[model samples]
Target: METTGTRRSLAWLVGIWALTRVVLLLFVFKVYAFPGPDVTSDVSVIYQGWYEVLRTGTFPLDDVTWQYPPAAALAILSPALVFWLDYTSAFFVLCFAADLVVLLLLLYAGLRSGRTSRGAWVWVVGVPLLGPTVYARYDVMVTGVAVAALLAGARYPRVMGALTAFGAMLKVWPVLLLVAARRRGSWVWAALTAGVLAALFALAMPGAFAFLTFQRDRGTEVESLGALVFHVARQYGWDGQVLLNYGSVEFLGPYVDVVSTAALVLSGLAFGWLLVWRLRARSFHVHTLADGAFVAVLMFVTTSRVISPQYMVWLVGLAAVCLCFRESRMGVPVGLVLVASFVTVLEFPVWFSHVVASDGLGVTLLFLRNGLLILAALLAARELWRSTVPLPTPPPVPTESPRLRETSLPS
Candidate 1:
């Protein structure tokens, strides 16, 4: 049933994916040096260290950088599946595999009737925009799970629920995927899966929940939306010092806490807005699940205290899912996110020194990237509301009496 043009376009998508991903694999494997900071150090060093600790039947209890849920141990330890290779190499290979899985899922979803290949195109194009960082971090693996969860949401609500819970266990953001779940089974399955996973991890690992305390003293990263205030203030003699805190470079001096708190409050308000939208929504289409998730994650990521470059992976994944549905009205937001993804790379490994120094180039990149995110969030929120929430009833049109109407017509 596939047309020649469709087949050709599909081939093009596959080819582009292969080429870009091969380049990414090369960069991650150090066949080619990437610019700025070595993003792969997190895998070669931090993740390798945690893999050592996790293999000893425990989490990294002594490391402040171990700030993920207990199930993240599975990700750190996944390299053992490829024991034929060294740890770092194996990890990069697995990340590449996860990226492939995501692409295939998007392709399957996009090729079906009532779906377009825009989602596949988004994944193919957007991932490369973030450069080799796509394969350098475990976030790509988490994103793969998130994409599968969204695509499965329409027909297999329980599967969606289980995947969502598993992904949240991995990175804590995929829980937002359930924001627009219409089936009660989805919620029930999610609760049961999360509870079971939490219990198992707590029993098996020593500091399964310790990540909660690890980030208590963190500050706003230089790339976050709220950090713009400090960036500009630094230009005007703000005394805050940027330092490596809690495993990420952040502002640690005066008013940093205030900005961080404001970020948290913004996240809180975003959540409140989502709840209100859900309550007011009267429409639930197949695409609404993806659209709502896209809006929800966008709001949180934009408002978070740490807008890390890898966070763009999550946005790109959700935006791809949204585009899979022909009826989804998230095209504008998705385009903005793709652009932001490019700017994210520019701000991170491309010119990261500028970002850390809060120089003109760094500030420009962050402002452009974060501003796009803010605009995307606001626009996506608006579209979701207009699409799902019931519109106000219009006034009835007045009609003339039959006698008057007949007389006027005769005249």
Candidate 2:
């Protein structure tokens, strides 16, 4: 009965949160205004356009901005099934459903673990705090895939691999989850991931590889951590231009390429650190994989050249999973991630103009958000390292031989 009551309480919280998001969508943000500057509006236009292409049996449309793998087309065109609703409405509904799926998975995982409701609370508080941006971006869908993969990872390697592969097709980041799998499980996951990815690429043909070329010419997004360097440089007479490139705020002109390259180098270093962490983890506990995943994702996001507002959805989901374990000592780091999520909303739809202008408030907000992320990454890494590194067992005490024991016994 207590378990039932807890479940009911969780259900009420989730239902209320979902309702608030819907209200925000209809009244506050009006995200269904397709083709507008709001990110989701652009996403809806692109998805609807892609749906038309799919209807014509084409793999990818000719738009250079369509910079995702072929499997993404499945998600992009999925809203077409709701014939009664327009594309914009259908896309919002789909994203909302995906958000709820993630919440359900987190809650179920927490209950199954027989741990405190920390994980469910993380999702419950974190997602809504991120505001409407969670629904406005399809990152929520990718996050759902990630949640399922991690929750199923220990018991079901193949399923984890397949889901990770599906997510990688949508966005490249989900592949990081494979790092947490055991050696044998990792191989199985890797094989299935590669096989599925290859099959999807084969089906899409030439268009499947187009995003690679499209991504090559990309500049540093103005809101990225790297852009903050350039933003500071601008005050010291650095010459550069900020513009909407490829549907994101990007820095162009002198030294932009150099900063972008430097971001890549930093990302490489972060990857190396993750590899070291994986090697040092001698034993895999129930929560080890989830904790490792959270650290890996935090490293990836903090060091990337593109730190979009929606990226918080990924961190929020992963952090929730980490907190599901009773042994996970990541409370401080998870709290930091939640704070960063709130700041992300402030940096985006709230004072995005200030950010674009590189004003004092904007720069400060970015600094706080990015700094919190970096701190969270470091703390999570430390926690995982301490938790996973096996302690040396003391040598067993030598026992007396049987004859010696008999001779020594009181007679």
Candidate 3:
């Protein structure tokens, strides 16, 4: 059923995806060194360490760095599937596969009737913009499932719900994909799938729920929006120490708690706004599912206490889904995210020493990156609210003066 032009476009997309992925693979494989700290060390050292413990039928209960949900163990252990390769190589290969799956899903959705390949282009271009970090973390794998759930949402609510639940278990953000879901079956399936998975993890592994208690004393991360306060304060002799805590580099003294709490309060406000939007929204379209999910994730990510580089993968994935629908109007926000992603790669893994030291370059990168995110959040929220929440009918403008109508001048 594909036309010649469609086939050519699909082929070109795959070609670009292949070319970019090869570059990413080379970086992760150490054939060429990426700048600054080695990003692959997380996989080669930390993840492999976790894999050793997880393969023994237990979580890394003693390691405070083991701060992910129980289902995350699946991702850490998934490298076992390719016994032929080393752990790091296998993990990168799986990440590459996940990336391919997302692109294929976008292409399938985009090439359909009433859809556009712009979404496929977004995925192709956005992933590489974040540089090799796209494959260095497990976030891309989680994003793959999230994209699948969003694309399936319009026609298959139950499938979408199950995938949403699974993706949420893998990482917590994908549950936001259900913000605009109207089908009761989607909610029902989501609840059922989540409950079953929770029970299975709890019964199968000790400390499967331990990650929930691990984040109690976390500090504001250096790359978070709130961290700009300390970044600026450090220049004025604020005595805070940047330390690796909770598996992330964080600001750990002198009002760090205040900024972290402020981030949490902002997150609460964002949640409240989402609840209000869902209740007041009166219009819904097939595209609204993806659009709503995109906005919801944007709200939380911008307000969260940590904005790790991999977080951009989630935004890029959701943005791709939104663009798949011709009716979705998230182009501006998506473009901002793409630009911010490029900034993210610069802030991390490239000049990260500057960021850790709170230097001029670091503060500038965070300012621009976080500023773009805040703007995108505001614009996306306005667009979603205006399109779905209906205006006040503009007070019904008068066609003629009251005096003319009184004089019987009306036709």
Choose the strongest candidate by TM-score.
1
Query: What would the per-residue lDDT of candidate 2 be over residues 196-315, giving only the tens digit for each residue?
Result: 776766775556767877778788987788989887887788878889787678988898889889999989999998888788788678888888889998999998888988899899
Error of 2 at 333 (Å): 1.1
Q: Name model 1 segments beyond 4 Å from true.
A: 395-411
Candidate order, lDDT descending: 3, 1, 2
For candidate 1, the 10 contiguous residues with the lowest summed lDDT are 402-411
* Model 3, residue 257: C-alpha shift (Å): 0.6
Clashes (backbone N, CA, C under 3 Å), per candidate, total 0, 0, 0
lDDT computed for candidate 1:
0.92
lDDT of each: 0.92, 0.81, 0.93
**TM accuracy, model 3:** 0.95
- Which is better, 2 or 3, measured by lDDT? 3
Which TM-score value belongs to model 2? 0.89
- With a 3 Å backbone cut-off (N, CA, C), the pairs that clash in candidate 2 are none
Give the alpha carbon lDDT tens digit for every residue of 16-135 in model 3.
Answer: 989998999999898999898989889999999999999999999999988788899999999999999999999999999999999989998997999999999999999998988888
lDDT tens digits, residue span 1-411, model 1 = 469889999999999999998999888888999898899998888889999889999989899988898889999999999999999999889998998999999999998989999999999999999988887789999999999999999899999999999999999999999999999878999999999999999998789999989867678988899899999999999998988888888887888889999999999999999999999999899899999999999999999999888999999999999999999999999999999999998888999999889999999999999999999999999999999999899999998999888888844
- Name the runs in model 3 displaced over 4 angstroms: 394-411
